[model samples]
Every structure is written in C-alpha cells, then in structure tokens.
Target: MAYKTEHITQQIRAAREAKNMSQRELSARSGLTQSHISQIERGTMEPGLSSLVDVARALDLEIVLAPKKLMPAIGNILGSASVTSDTLTSEQRKLVGRLERWLAGVRDQFSIASEADTLKDSLALLRHLPLSADELDRLREATLHLNRWQDDPPSRKELSEFAHAVRQLRNATVHRDRDGAVPRSAYALEEEDDDA
Candidate 1:
C-alpha cells in the first residue's frame, strides 16, 4: 500500500492548528528548525522518527494504534464534545481552577526538581494527572497497601514510586488490543499482527 504522506502531514498540521500554535511555536517547542517544521506541515518533507517523536511530545500526544473497527469510538472519545470551560458548572469550574493552580505549582516543582538535578520532573508531571474524583479516591485507597506506602504525606521517593505505579496503570489500561500489543505507524494492521 502507498504511504499517504499528505494524510500524515495534514494530521500534524491540524493538531498544531487545534492547539493554536504556529509552525515557529511548534519548532521552538520541538527544538526543530522552523523551516523543517514548515516543510513537514506543508508535506514537502517526511519527518524522521526522532523528529516525529519530538513533535508529538511538543503536542502532548501519544501515537497509539487500535483495531480499525475501534477507530471511530477512539476518535469520539478524543473529540472535544465534552462541556466547554465556559459552560462548566460552578463546582466544576472551581475544581478546574484548583487544578489549574495546582498545575502551575507543579510546574514550579518540576523546575525545582531540575534545579536539584533529579528525575523529579517526571514524577511531578505524573502526580498532576487529571483523574476524576472517583479515580483519585480509588488511588488513595490503593496507596495504603502499596509496598512503598508512606505516611499521610509521602516523601519524594514515595511520590516517585506512586507516579511509577500510576504510569504502570496507564500503560496497562490504555492502547491495548484484544491481544494487548499496539503498533506505531502501520497504516493498516497485518493479518498476523506485529508488535511495534
């Protein structure tokens, strides 16, 4: 089958547009030259794997593969059909405000982690996952039985462990098929599936 470079480039351009970012902004975020990013979005250049990864990271996106039949459902969930920020209920708005403030604080914490020269940024980011209240409660309950469970306020190491656990949960729950392997960049799944 022919590779649809146009489709690939179009999706990248659309993603950047949806985020309201210009090619120059994306280039800054992804550490690629603006000309390269422009070439990429214009379909004049096919990005290398590393370039694609950098761009995806800048967009806070993960490239997951699913069965063709499930694409519609996946697309629906990823679509912005949920209530907009402007329409949020008062309580919902408060929660969102709190979360946004917390994120700002966490960004500082991540910077501090960097200043300290530790791998704490990853932990800080994972701790800020926008889990629902129910999920938060469930995670808290599960924390009691964790092998590294600490006191009411977990230490940096304990927090790191918790973040690792959350990452584990995310990996297990997302991007899995019936047989549990998700490939990357195969336009179509093969009759005999392959793991990427």
Candidate 2:
C-alpha cells in the first residue's frame, strides 16, 4: 500500500513538472488547498477518492482500472504510441547518442564542453516543442549534419556555430507552436439516440 501511494505521488509530481505547472497552480486548478496537495505529493497524506479524482482531472489525467493480467499489453501499446507521437526520429536519436558519447570522451576540454552543453540543452528544448512536418524535416537535416560530424571532434568554433543553429531551431519552434499541444481526452461523450 505504501509502495502504491509512492508510485502514484511520483507519477503526479512528474506529470505536473512536465506540464511546467507549479504546485500552487495545480492546487488552484484542482480546488485543493496547497498544503493538502503538498502533503499528498510528499506521500505524508493519503488522498481520498474525491481528492484524487480532482487532482487527476486538474492534471489532465483520469484514473482507470485495468485487469492485472493485461498490464503488460497496455504498457507496450502506450510506449509505442509515445515514440510515434514524439518529434524525434530513430536516426536523430542515434545521432544524439553518438554525440553524447563523443562529448563524454572529451569532457575535460573547457571550450568544447561549453558548446556541447549548449547544443545538448537546445536539443532537449527542441524535443519537447510541438513541431510541424516542415520543422521536423529541418531538424532531421540538422541531425544528419551532426551525424556526419560524429566521427570527428568539431573545433570549438564549429561546435559553437552548430549550437547556435540548434538554438535558432528551438526559438523558431517555440514561436510557431504558440498554443502548445493539446492532449487527447481520456473520456469520450456519447450522443443520445433520439429515435429510440
């Protein structure tokens, strides 16, 4: 029971952070006291069903019961869907991994480390932003260039230039995706059959 509460709290905290929401904001949205939310998130208080539902709904989530035996299948489906929906492609992931390995090998170099850090930070931002197909293609092209450089350590100047380009890409994405992405609702409303 303690483990379940911890897991639930962790999930709720992670979701709230991912949405860039503060605890007070969530409290306001959920109609719960900030201290109550804090206690719940810390696992110091066990939330009642109604409070849990309120918090979940405020986080754009809902609780659902699934057969224990079907958990693995559900996990697999959701995992694949997440990968498909994300902006990163397999090739881009490979390139990023390759770059990270290279960066790790030369972490002692101050100039290279600074530029590498910038590139890495920009990449993280780029991954989170909702991108159009054309913007995604642009990202693919950038990753392809980065892939070609994977075998060679770029000079500080070159790395800085690449980092700048990635930041520009991230900025453009943010400007274009002003509204952010809307998540799919968990429940669907059914229309009543008037003829019946």
Candidate 3:
C-alpha cells in the first residue's frame, strides 16, 4: 500500500498546533526546513519516510501502521476461508513485536514484585501503552525500578512527576486523533488565590 501522505501531513500539522508549537520550532527540532514543513502541511509536498520519522521523533510521537482489512470481494466463487489471514505491513509488524516484548518485560517485573505500590506502578505503565512501542522499553525499565523499591516506595513528589510525564506523553500521542484524542473537558487547571 502507498503512504497516505496528505492524511499524515494534516495529522502532523494538527498535533503541532495542539502542542502550541510553531513550524519553525518543529523545523529546528527535526532538522528540517520551515518551508518544507509548511509545504508538507499544505499538501503541496510529500515527506520521505526518513523525514517523517524525524518529525515524529521531534514531537515525541510514534508512527504505527495497522493492517487495512480489505472487504471480501462480492459474489466471490471461493469461500471466505480461502482468504488468508490479513497481515500487517513490515513496519507495523515490527512495531507490534517490539510492543509485545516490552509488555512481556513489564509482566515479568510485575510477577517478581510483591508490593502494592510496585503493582500500582506496573498498572500505570500498562495504562500508557500507545500504539507505537517507542517509549515502551523506557517505561518498562522505570517500572522495574519502582518494583525494586517495594521496601521503600517512591516519594509522593516522584510519583507526581511520573504522572505528569505520562500525561504529557499521552497528550503528544493522541493530540491529532479525532475519535480517541484526550478531551480537554476531562481536566481542569485551576489557579489558587493567596488571599484565600
């Protein structure tokens, strides 16, 4: 299948905007030209695979390709069983494999840990499993450390920071998704008055 350049381009533009980043900022982070990003967003140019990877990296996003299940042909003489199982493309397969490995590692750590706090961290890791496994390994490692700290659980400050970082990462991942994107209505940032 061919790359859906226009769709991906629009998603990138929307994610950038949601993050309150400028084209120049993205260009500087991804080492691409501002004009190039503009053109890509405007649908006048299609970025190469490498450029797309760079942009995703700069935005701390992961690109995942899922198999497009084609509809069975109408009035087919053959039975449905004749159709082979739909397979993910090479890129998609690689990502799935990586995620599975990371999940397995987390499971192993969870099994070894015997503390509620450690289990909670493992649960948190599972909650942030995005489609792309780019950060999965890192999260798995962090959870392993938390598990080892069963005797002395992380401080409240540490847990707060971890939660904030996870939220930021989740925001970056789903910023462009229409249906599953994080809703602003779910969270409220309120200011407190010193006088009160």
Give stretches of model 2 more than 4 Å off.
1-3, 81-84, 88-196
Higher-lDDT candidate of 2 and 3: 2
Computed on alpha carbons, the lDDT of every model, listed in order, comes to 0.53, 0.65, 0.53
Order candidates by TM-score, high to low: 2, 1, 3
TM agreement with the true structure for every prediction: 0.42, 0.43, 0.39
lDDT of 3 by residue, 1-196 (tens): 2346877787788779978999999999999999998988887777898999888888877676633221111112012212332421344335334434443444433323333344344344334333335444444545464555456655545555554554454443333222334323222223232221
lDDT-sorted candidate list, best first: 2, 3, 1
Clashes of each: 0, 0, 0
lDDT of each residue in 37-60, candidate 2, tens digit only:
999988888888888889999999
lDDT of 1 by residue, 111-181 (tens): 23542223234223324333344434544544443333222444555545544554543333233332224
Positional deviation of residue 178's Cα in model 3 after best superposition, in angstroms: 12
Compare candidates 2 and 3 on TM-score and give the better one. Answer: 2
Q: Determine the C-alpha RMSD for candidate 2 after optimal superposition of all C-alphas.
A: 15.2
Candidate 1 structure, TM-score to reference:
0.42
